[model samples]
Target: MAWSEADAARNRELWTQTNADYTAGSAPAAWAREEMGWGIWQLPESQLRVFEGIDLEGLAVVELGCGTAYFSAWLAKRGAHPVGVDVTPAQLETARAMQEQFRLEFPLLEANAEETGLPDQSFDLALSEYGASIWCDPYRWIPEAARLLRPGGHLVFLRNSTLVILCSEDEVPAVERLVNPQFGMHRFEWPDGGVEFHLAHGEWIRLLREHGFEVEALHELQAPQDAQTHEAYDYVTADWGRKWPAEEIWRARKR
Candidate 1:
């Protein structure tokens, strides 16, 4: 859905609330943090595993909307020169602090995903896990992503999709439900539960095509194993294993 000025205002407020939480180092609930270990939530373990199998030791990479710089941190650990960009300064600050704390050398920048301040063809790979979808205009951002990526560069992203298999409403924690209703094949929720938007799968493919990306791969991923703790694994796997596609992952290359 198109965002009205009022919608933008509401989104700003919601993001502000989320950034405040990040600044406060508010720990994501067990499930949210669980993704960190297992690659659910916004973490991209599956993609990272794929990256590890290849040679990325010297590539210039950018993680768009890199909240907390988790992925950037991961890449840096692997010897890639990575930059983390985000629209929220609070998030950037948190990411920067984490980098410093971990002695990670990655750079963090504050910028909009649709219009990053970086120069053209500045990166060999632009990765966005659960970030680009939330932008005000993904169509605009897709080309920006392409522009930032050099010719033959790649864009790896994860998006919420329509074909998701849901966990039992009872299994998920209560606070997470605050944003649950906003997410699906059709809708999205911001951090504060203050705004919702309609987003669809076709829009993602069309956006990539319009921006000069050749689709490489797109598919649903199984529920992240670490997203549920060991104790809950049996129950979660039994209930959601067959059904739950935790999210969608997309891979594309600049053409």
Candidate 2:
């Protein structure tokens, strides 16, 4: 199997085991239908204004790694047509259950984010919130996203900052000093059995441009003052997160 295929297989197992824990938290259950947030901090979109001038209604949106797909449900409620794609069937199962419970329905596909097997130029916006952004290889999945979008379509995603990844390794919390070298950073494997991808900001800009995307903006996410404690995400402490960005949102447009 290819690296991504192996990652997909591992994801199926890891997510299948942890999906219930997600459902227990503010995931598919307590997430507000009207509100939209990004990352584990759940920072308010209104405050961040990631979509300041973009109209969402009536657009075809594809969420790359929508594990449980609460973001898709939120988009559906806002009148946008959203299709969620994920590798784990267990995650999609929970998403399907939420669709019925919330009365907000959208299509969900079980596929690798790196190659969704969907038609090209079919989406107006592509989104991922700590989903494909971190889990999939940027070198492959980004081109896939570009292929899946029409000219002028947008690509938005949230992932950990390169700084955080360089500061820490595996499942460990970020330290005060840089523990890893930044040169040629790409793939990361955790000792606990999982994989992730992080790239430098300069690399990201170049990648977006090379793939016919116009770099729009990069939002370095500061943890909200009232950000609730999340047991699942302990990679950054509230104090450290408040001082430096632990996560970021990248917004780009197909050109």
Q: Using Cα atoms with residue i matched to residue i, what is each candidate's TM-score against the true structure?
A: 0.71, 0.95
Q: What TM-score does candidate 2 get on C-alpha atoms?
A: 0.95
Per-prediction backbone clash count: 0, 0
Best by lDDT: 2
**RMSDs, each prediction?**
6.1, 1.5
The parts of candidate 2 lying over 4 Å away from their true place are 226-229
lDDT per residue as tens, model 2, 64-84: 989888888887887899999
List the global CA lDDT of all models.
0.60, 0.86
Q: After superposition, how far is residue 183 of candidate 1 from its true place, in Å?
A: 16
The per-residue C-alpha lDDT of model 1 at residue 21 equals: 53
